[model samples]
Target: MLALVSAPTNLGLRPPQPGSVPGASKAPEALREAGLFELLRVGGAREAGAIVPGRYVDDDATRPPGRVRNESALVAHALRLAGRVGTILDAGDAPVVVGGDCSVLVGIGVALARRGGTGLIHLDGHTDFRHPGNSGACASVAGEDLAVAVGLHWPAIADIGGLGPYFAPGRTAHLGHRDDDERATEARDLLGAVVSAREARQTASATTAARIHAVAGTGYWLQLDVDILDPDVMPAVDSPDPGGLDTGELGALLRELAPRAIGASITVFDPDLDPDGRCARALVDLLAAPLTTLGSALR
Candidate 1:
């Protein structure tokens, strides 16, 4: 079974300044408007209902650059999201989580960690290992998804459920990252292994997926960030980087990973930029095709 978990959030972003429009918090509704949920339902996946956060609060983008923004609200909502995920898992459905930002990983990571032995397959354009408090970059937890997941960032987030780290270093795999940001500059004592975009392209996506599965065992949580797509094709992201995969490339990659996923989350697609909805259509197709494959494989 499959369930769509909605985390309509921008908390993981730097929070909104006074006049700023929203960022990825608009993703779930946008994709739904594009008929993603209805299409998935046609494949027999159920709309398990959106996991709404209790409240949302964001810091101004002007906060001291290196300060992690909205720490309190972020932690609180993550706990709430974790419960939602736990409930879905208890019902025995693999949750297809949609995100507010990468920060939603806090809840996903925590739930997986508590359940024990679950590994992570992180696919993104950037490494996302920066902990600004330690690395001196601007503080955005979305920028620190990997670090936070492994108990290297905020104590409230990383240490959720009294678990120290969500995924042990060796059990996690980071893939498709271009490594163009502060991630290149930070020291990665907490991250264990990674399969870079260049390395993945050097081989087949199947090879990379096999390596990820080898590390993760029978099940893993898959985190797919759309920014990992080439900017020419997927420009509706908060941070657009080049030298990444296209929608077809990502679909091919998912052909190997989707069937193995215990749960999955799609993040960082900003519909605000795609006024004509072209990107939204592409995202729905990308999501539906692999998910259809996943549903069949599980059956």
Candidate 2:
């Protein structure tokens, strides 16, 4: 059985500028409305409920500038998600989590940790290890989820579930990161067996999975960020960068990886940007393939 979970919090994104729709929060419903659940019929599935943020206060006196904005709500939100995901795992069902953003990974990490330390597979275009800024200006805490999970960021998030550094440095593999070195410098210091986009091109997905699994050992959780797909095919993200794998490449990777994952989450596809509904359908089609195989394997 598979438990379909929804996390609709966008506190990780840049705050809405007036009338703009912070579209990521709408992803859970959008995906369901697009027939994603029906298309990938498993033993069971349902929304895990949404977590919209409330209140924002600057705490520059204690926190680094901007890191404190929505800090309390986001941390509490992750714990809440951890509880929900823990229940899903305890029920002996693999979790197919849909997200509000990458920050949801913190909660997923928390849940996985209690099951006896798990490894992580992060598939994204950007390294997403953007350093927590010291410029006294607000930087996104949401974007640094990987950092937080590994104990490089705030202690509050890193220490959730009463465990620090959810995935060991040697156990995590970050693949398909095509972003520049400057953005990933801090993050690079902490990772292991990171496959760059260039290296990923030369290596097959199964080969990559084997290398990652060797380190991950027993099991791992897969984190899929939609922005990892090329903007030409997945242009609905908030920060679409240049150069990414096509859906075919992504599907191939998922097929090789998903069956082995204890749980997985798909993040950052904004329905508002996909005006014609093409991206939504495309996402469902792409996910349905491996998810079907993954569900059966889990069953």
Candidate 3:
């Protein structure tokens, strides 16, 4: 059985005009329709105010307080969700988490790390490894999530899920990265390999899957941030970059890798930025293909 965990509370940061965002309101529904939630029960932390703290951009009064109550709540919610998902995984259940933001990765990573050494296949446009003291082009909490997961930025995100140093540098692989900012330097320093978007575009999905399989070895988690897709395909992101993996290519990669990996999870942020919900539906469909395969194999 595969458990579908929902962490829909956007506690870390709230994007601009969250409520008005088309897919933002219907993420849970989309997941349900995709049958991603069929096997497992749903759980999450309490919803805070609608307007939360803006990690990357300035705050907007129009949003609800649910955006920003406290960082501790976000961490607590993640820890709880991770604990539940970990318990399921231990009991032979595959866990696929739907997200509030990329920060949910911290909880999922912690859970996978506690069980054993887990490789990380991070798909995103940015490396997200900014340290506390380091100042660069993009400096924000969200930008440093990857760094925090690997114990690069201590104290700020250390308490999340009660797991430190989520995964080894050598066991991590970054795919579909096109944008480079200040955090890029830190990522290069910490990550084993950062695969460029160009390389991913040129290479076949099967080839890319093979590379990830080789690098990640056994027992890995798949963390995807939708911004890795081109703005034309996924414009609802907090920061959408140009030139990203197409839906078909990404689906093929996921399907090829799902059975090979030990466990996997995905997170979608700023869905509210997508008014039409087209991006959300596409992501759901792409992810569902592999998830269904994984669930069937597990059964």
Per-model CA lDDT versus the true structure? 0.78, 0.74, 0.62
- Please rank every candidate by lDDT, starting with the best: 1, 2, 3
Query: By summed lDDT, which 10 consecutive residues of candidate 1 come out lowest?
Result: 184-193
Provide backbone clash counts, one per model.
1, 0, 13
* TM-score of model 3 vs. true structure: 0.79
State TM-scores per candidate: 0.91, 0.88, 0.79
For residue 245, what is the lDDT in candidate 1? 85
Candidate achieving higher lDDT, 1 or 3? 1
Q: lDDT by residue for model 1 over 1-299, one digit each (tens)? A: 88888888777775445656457888999999998888988987887777665454555644554346677777778887888888888888888888768888988887877787488888888988876456756467888888887777757667876886888877777877885555633423444457666777778877777777787665778899888898898999888888888777788889888887888999999888899999999999888978765633554
**Can you tell me which runs of candidate 1 are displaced by over 4 Å?**
15-21, 54-67, 179-192, 295-299
Error of 1 at 233 (Å): 0.7
**Which pairs of residues collide in candidate 1?**
9-100
Please give the lDDT score at residue 295 for candidate 3: 39
